[model samples]
Target: MDLHGPLRDASDTILASRAIDGDLVAFEVIAHRHGPLMRVLAANLLGSELESDDVVQEAFISAWRHLGELNDPARIRSWLMRIVSNRALDRIRARRHHDDIDAADRASTGPSTEALVEHRMQLDAVWIALGRLPADQRRCWLLRETAGYSYAEIGETLDIPVSTVRGLLARARATLLLEMEAWR
Candidate 1:
C-alpha cells in the first residue's frame, strides 16, 4: 500500500483506533512503525536476533487479535512491547537449553575496532551499574528509559503507584550516574 500517505503520519491513537475497526492498512502502518523497536526488545530478551523476528511476528498477531481489548489507544507502543516481551519470555522458557553466545555481540556490526571497543566498554559499565540496582529500581528505570514507558504506564505495568515509579527511577538514575562516573 501507499505507506507514504496520510495514514503513515497519523498518531498512534488514530492508527490504533483504525486498527481496532479492522482497518488492515492502519494495522500495517502500526506494525511498520513499531516493528524494529519491538524486534530489538525481543532480541534482547531472547538473546537471539534470528528468533526475535518470530517473537515480534507472534506479538503482532496477538496484538491484532486483542486490539479491541486495549484500554488506551495512545499507549499502543507500550502495549506492543509488553506483548513482544511476553512472547520472548515464552520462547526462552520453551527452549531446552540456552546458547553461550551473546545477542549484543551478534547485533553489533561494521564499527571500527576502536569505536566498537569504546562503545562496548561504555555499555558494559551501564550494565554493571544496572546490575547493582535494587530489582524494583532497575525494573522501573528500564521500563522508563529502555522501553520508553511513561511513569504512569510503568506504574500500571508493575502494579505500583506512579509516585513509587518516580522514586525508583530517581534512585536508579542517581546510582547509575555515580557508577558510570566512577567507571569513567
Candidate 2:
C-alpha cells in the first residue's frame, strides 16, 4: 500500500490552506504528492508520457493560480485530476486537428508478429465498440474506469448528476457487452 497519495491526512488540507495563503513550499509539497498520478492519467488519455508531463505541469500551474477558489482542500487530488483531464482532452483535440489523414505509417517498433496481430485486433475491436458510445457516456466510462473516480467525483468533474453518471455507465456497459459478444 502506498502510504503517500491522500491517506486521510490533515496534511493535504493544511498544505492546501497554506498554499492558498501564498506559501510556495506548501504548494510544492502538494505538487510532489499528486503529480505522478496526474501524469499517468494524462498519459493514458493522450498516449504519450512526455506530453503527459507537459499537461500535468500546466495543470499544476493552473491549480496554483486558482488555489484560492478550491472549495474542499481534501478533495484536491480529484480537482487536480480534473484539470489534467481537461488539459489532456484539449491536447487530443489539437492533435486531431493537426493530423494528416493521408500520411502513411512512419515507423514501427519490433514486436513478434503473432503478438502484434492479436493485440492490434483486440484494440481495434475495443476502440470500435467505444466509438459507438455517445460522447457523454464515453467520457463517463473513461473517467470512472481509467481515473478510478467515484460517481460523485465524476459528476463533479463533468458537472453532471450521480444518477446521470450511473445511467450513462449502465448504457455504455450494455452497448459494450453486445459489441464484445463475438469475442467472448
Candidate 3:
C-alpha cells in the first residue's frame, strides 16, 4: 500500500466513503483502478482509440459528480463501467448522426493485394459480419463482449430487458458464426 494511497480502506467501502467526503486523492485512486477498463469499453464501443480518452474522461467527471448517490461502494467498479459505457454510447450515436451523410461517399482504405495480411483479413470478415446485424443486435453484442457486461447490465444500459439482451446476443453470435465459417 502506498502510504500516500487515497482512501484509508483499500477496500472499496472506505475508499468511496473518503471520496464522498471530497477527497480528491481517493477519487484519483478509483480512477486509476478502473480507467483501463473504461478506456477499453469506450474504445471498443466507438471503434476509435482517439475518442476513448475523452469518453473515459467524461465518465470520470460524471463519477465525481454523482459518487455521493452511489449506495454500494463495493460495486463502484460496475457503476463506473456503466457510466463509461453510456458515455461511449452517446459519443457513438452523435458520431453516427454527424457522419451518416458523408459515410456513403467514403471509400474504404485497405492493404493492397501484395501486402495482404491474414489477421487483418479475418478482422475484416468479422467486421463485415457484424455490420450485417441489426443496429440493436450489434450494439448489444459489443456491449456484452467488449465491456464484459452481464445481460442485466446491458439491459440497464440499453433500456431493455435481460431476455432481450440475451436474444440479441444470441442472434448476433449465430450470424457472425455462420458468416465467419469460411475463415475456419
Candidate 4:
C-alpha cells in the first residue's frame, strides 16, 4: 500500500538488498539519497554541472541494472560514487578523442594581448600543463587539489591503492612543477 514510505527510512544496506530483489522503490530511494553527492563528485571530476547530471543519471541506471552484482550492499554509496567517477572519466576520454576540427581551430586562436595578463597567463599555462599529464595523474591531482579530497579518499574513489595514489600524486606534482618552472 505504501511502498515508498518504508524505503525512505531504510538503510542503504536494506535498500540495496531490496533493489537487488527487483524492488524499484528501493532503487529509487537509493538514487534520491545519493544523487546530489554523486552529482557533485561528477561535477568536480568533469568540471561541468550539466555533464555531471548526465553522468549521475547514467550511474543510477547502471546501478539499477547491476544491483545484483554488488558484493557488499552496505557500501552502496561508495559503489555508486565509483560508478559516477568511471562514467565521468569515460566522458573525459570521449572528449579527448572526439577531435572536432572546428572546436580545435577555435581553441587554437591565440589569446588577445590584453587578455594575456600575468595571472591569466600563469593560469593558462597550468591548465595546458595539466592537460599534458596522463589521465590518471590528472584525475588524482584534481581530486586532491580541486576537490580537497584526502589521498585515501582519492584512492577509494578511483579504486586504486593508497600507495598508488601517493605515487601518482608525486609524479603529477613533479611534472607540474617542471612545466611551471618558467612561471616561477
Candidates sorted by lDDT, best first:
4, 1, 2, 3
Which structure is stronger by lDDT: 2 or 4?
A: 4
State each model's CA lDDT, in order. Answer: 0.81, 0.78, 0.77, 0.83
lDDT of 2: 0.78
lDDT of 4 at 37: 85
Candidate 4 lDDT (Cα, 0 to 1): 0.83
lDDT of 3 at 2: 58
Give per-residue CA lDDT, model 1, range 25-140, as digits (tens). 99999999999988877776666899999999999999999998999888888788778877875686566235223443465575555665676678667767876888788767
Ranking by TM-score: 4, 2, 3, 1
Which regions of candidate 3 fall more than 4 Å away from where they truly are? 1-9, 100-103, 106-141, 145-184
Compare the candidates by TM-score and give the number of the best one.
Answer: 4
For each candidate in turn, give its C-alpha RMSD to the true structure in angstroms.
9.2, 7.8, 8.6, 6.2
Model 2 C-alpha lDDT per residue in residues 164-184, reported as the tens digit of each score: 999999999999999989888
Q: What lDDT is reached at residue 11 by model 3?
A: 76
In model 2, which residue pairs have backbone atoms overlapping below 3 Å?
none
Query: Alpha carbon lDDT of residue 137, candidate 1?
Result: 88
lDDT of 4 by residue, 159-182 (tens): 689999999999999999999999
Which 10 successive residues of model 1 have the least lDDT summed? Answer: 96-105
* Position 9, candidate 4: lDDT: 88
